[model samples]
Target: MTNVSPSGPASERSTGRRVIRILIAVLVVLALVVVCFLVWAKAVMQGERPAALEAWTDDRVSIESFDDSVVMTPIDAASDRGLVFIPGAKVDPYAYLAKLVDAVAETGTTVVITKPTLNLAFFDTRPLDTFTRHAPDVDEWFVGGHSLGGVKACMMAADEEVAGLVFFGSYCSNDVSDSDLAVLSISGSDDGLSTPDKIEGAAHLLPADATFVEIEGANHASFGDYGVQPGDGVATASDDEVRDEITDALVAFWGGSGE
Candidate 1:
């Protein structure tokens, strides 16, 4: 018989090497994709310092920035009620200070604005205590957010310590219609991102008694002081107008008393 030169073993070795090389190449490509995604996610919309400065200087409310959250408390008489507010996707936590300052001052409700992981709320998987822990004094806690952040808040509304839910130009994807949690859905009439129709469509997801408010001429970006967003509607309502409406709604929702 003619010698085959052990060709079978050689062929098997060559095939195995090719497979290894292919797997290495795939892994390298996957790694690069992950890196690019993280880089893009980290690039976030910065909050306007001038507007944020207003909140910092306000004597009525005290603002404190921590590694994971920004806490705003009323200087005179703080309320037992507190809110854990999450920022919209890619928005800086400070962007909300200006809009929320009035609420903190008027309601005396401690506001904790969270710095979500990867600058996006959906990526943050921590429990409610992760933020509420900052305000050990707060007895009743409400969770809220803007846009995508509101969706994340809805997910956490079921927590035992959570007393309510608030949305700013956002709606819940998960059903909490049966839950007795007090829910507030605030939407912008001129919002191009979370359009009026979208909010109305998702209305059934909230509790039957959920309160809804529409800020006329307000756009998606009006909810924060982060300048104009790329796909947002033109805001006919001035910043002051939006702020007043939001503050009023919040006060009314909490039974017109922060205490």
Candidate 2:
């Protein structure tokens, strides 16, 4: 009979089992930590309660009676250039992009934010008509929006009324015939809602001279100020950082020529 050491096979098996258990335990602890951080961040940074978001309400920006289609919030600013922000469908203007108005205004442009009256799939251009009516006196103009609102910016620029266009997370439908307007399309590589393919398609629709910039890690919702739940979408650095990039690009684009 062959003599076998008692510690050989048994010791190896025991060590393997212990190593597996330790790995499992470490994984569980890491998952819990992630869950805890997400909860804390959402509660402090992105509270869902109506009251938490209500604190941002502005009586000065509120226009009680304008054209039925459009609502504008005029910001205090230092430049003659006008910046209009039209929001996407089913979204409250104050909820997402409101945190960004002051940031855009800091670059020496007046902000005119539009809150849509109707809710649904179909987009209405009537709201823009109301804005055109109000800003007849401004010398220089710039239009921009979040998501579908970016399409509206393109539409406004195409009309030859505005000097430039800024699109945030918007797609260009195949029917882009307006090349006279200057275009700036900004999107993120990780944004699931608007893929890189869609952004490239939109770029093709623009004139060859149009400007395009892509943020490496941003998602659709990240372009706006509101912090989304962790798993719901891609997490970007911060709204302030993204908005700064946009404003600097816009200011530089306009600085060269009146257009």
Candidate 3:
């Protein structure tokens, strides 16, 4: 009988398999990097970014109101489908969503752009809580945000009383549980932050009646007012157009839902 070491052939074979797996992973990663590069190039370098945004924002305007925990910047509209915009991390709520407010108002719906604490950053739900407390008779209330603001919207939808939810340049994670309410998920084609795959996945996070829209060649910054200014350098879309498209879709969705 020949006695073979238990750690000899078996270990060698295991190491070989491990090496092959690692090589495969490396190749997959490299392929992904290439694909990402191509997407970025096509969406950002060669796409209509600033001009598209400017076309919408050139004639934008807004109105404001001073609430307790929120300075509501309502867009010009005549509809009853109310919308409350929550800004992204480290951004000024009212300032960033001014154009959005105006756009929603133009659609005949009321809009309130909130100003949260700490310049409206993070996934804080306290602002929503405060707004709910102060304005108890708004009739209808929809919540939406950018980046972390999206997360907050999900949180609000999950626990708080909201008519709907909207996400701009943001993703709805698996943590959301608001399936009964309406949802609208929007993203830019060039938005590296929130990819189509992620945005598509968000559909599952909401009810079966949710809606999704993608703006080709839009960047993460363009989802906010950054893209509105001519030389803002924050994104490719102008603030006016971005907000207009967003509010239009939101109004349509909200109105269609009939809730």
Candidate 4:
């Protein structure tokens, strides 16, 4: 006699039930992903980078071509200091030139502003590895960013090789609060997104040597060239004024080429 398995209506019903459960689970997972995508899309900024300004830059900063699509290399090769910047979520890579190239570029520090996936820095925090491996000429290296980019840079600042970390209207997420690396946190008094209160509260994460500077009347949206941010406060300072202040503080912290 040969042993046989159940092959009747009862077995068929059980198999059908398992198949239905699997399909429901897959559908639930797909729905969750869709909801997440929807939320992300709603937060996306639709501003375009004002590229015509690049032509006016003239000889100030020579925009260099690199192998990585994730970075915009605006190099002032005369300087010894280098900064790898991470752009804020939904902001264009070139938009950062408004602040960085205008202020720090002339200070003799070459700046590389990374274009993160969907303009979100957390998605590609380590893209600077490409430049670090290839650019041996830069003796001093710093990692910096605006908003979410700054928080992510906190993680990179832990590297023994990174000389310092800079934040523009941003704060660290307690990751490098105790790090010995030099930290410069700049916030705008009018920035509603990264409010002065929040930035002050985050000071505990920074080392004793960390420097925090607040711009008199700048807003979070002014940190980049993009138009007004959704939840930003009105800025009392012109872009030139705020940018200049930020550059001054940055140069003081990093000892730029002018130093």
Candidate 5:
């Protein structure tokens, strides 16, 4: 009875209050982080709608827009071969329509362009089937992307269903050297972000037979019709030229035609 002074109860109350304060502070910080991320994602480079409109209206390919993706199918015929293309981070999916139209029209290949989460491919955790399902007629599928999207595509290349891997201004982070999956790495010669040296350095990650193509005078943003990108080199190749080279490379990789 050495004058406890009823301090035990008071101390317990103070400890509980301190815990509540810490929890509230944590919640506030989390909320702020979420808010800032959303803001940053929203402030993305918009695609050229006028250029994209041409692809949407092209009679060679039928275009269908979905909540999570856009499907482009050849009107004349549908090939068993398909391509699932992902756009660069924060780049509009429509921006890539014009570039990929030739793949569908000329090759009769079904093309599915994914709309990544938060406008970034890294945030999207969906499986390969998520976009492929849009083209139920396609059996043989190739996975590809531009910039950051290509990096994500590399991750999906491990799926057994994927017939091949294609990279545009990007390279794989993981090792696929032991895998037999066919890989086509197409890079822009003038790319500032994903420089030729970087692609060459990561070449060992791909299979020994992986094909590498460098588009002359092309830059990081040449893969799509997106106006411009920060920290990207100046592109000397016209949009049409870049698209033509891409179509040629794809056709060659697929052995002349989609069949």
Candidate 6:
């Protein structure tokens, strides 16, 4: 029999195995670092939580969490109008409960607030489709969002499941100027981010019949319970005052224009 030796090839194989293990260990460490960084980044993005969300607590309102969304329904039988809301980029979806609860209670509309991926709606644009599947009982469905979230909502409104669109301090980058979908655009007078000038300038992107309303003393961050956002103008209206008008605007829109 030929003499058998294990050293040469065995040593090379062992070296390759060690290299593979070292690479895997390095990858694991990098993954952990990335995870920790994302957590920290999201936490840092949070702003002062507004009192409006707490103040609107009503027993008539029922709250539930669905896949990455918060559904606020009236405890009593509500109007068949349904709304899917997208929060502003990096803002907590819960920040809107105060601002939206009164609207839901006052208008008898069922509202679902979709929490976007990493708080950015553009990353996942099918929120209307997702909300529709969850709200089969709604006779009519509308999609709305704040800031970047609204932009994505408008993008998704092309779906047949959506009957209307609402933009809270947001604009449509898509050319829906020809669509017959009812559009209600609410903006803040003092909003530096989605300023009045910018909104008016982009009016052509929307249908000619779109309803545009501006809250007298409101600002960009006034649309949600998150306090002053970076690069936002100083709000001249109290949070409650701003929210009240916003609720009224929504009620009128959903009942009149969006019907």
Model 1: which residue pairs collide?
Answer: none
- Candidates in order have lDDT scores of 0.91, 0.60, 0.60, 0.75, 0.89, 0.81
Model 3: which ten-residue window has the lowest total lDDT? 40-49
Q: Is candidate 4 or candidate 6 better by TM-score?
A: 4
How far out, in Å, is residue 9 in model 2?
A: 98
Query: Could you give the candidate ranking by lDDT, starting with the highest?
Result: 1, 5, 6, 4, 3, 2
Error of 5 at 136 (Å): 1.4
Evaluate model 5: give its TM-score. 0.92
Comparing 2 and 6 by TM-score, which wins? 6
How does model 6 fare in lDDT? 0.81
Worst ten-residue run, lDDT, model 1? Answer: 250-259
Error of 4 at 103 (Å): 3.0
* Winner by TM-score: 1
Q: What 10-residue stretch in candidate 2 is worst by lDDT? A: 43-52
lDDT of 1 by residue, 65-90 (tens): 89899999888768899999999999
TM-score of each model, in listed order: 0.94, 0.62, 0.62, 0.81, 0.92, 0.80
What is candidate 4's lDDT per residue for 70-96, written digit by digit as tens?
232335435666788887887766676
lDDT of 1 at 206: 90
lDDT (10s digit) by residue, model 2, range 2-111: 99866988899999999999999999999999998656433323323352233246432433234432333334444466667676544545444344443444454555
Using TM-score as the yardstick, the better of models 4 and 5 is: 5
Better of 2 and 6 by lDDT: 6
Please state every model's RMSD to the true fold in angstroms.
Answer: 2.1, 14.5, 11.8, 4.9, 2.5, 5.5
Please report the candidate that would top lDDT against the real structure: 1
Model 6 ranges off by over 4 Å: 1-41, 44-56, 125-127, 256-259
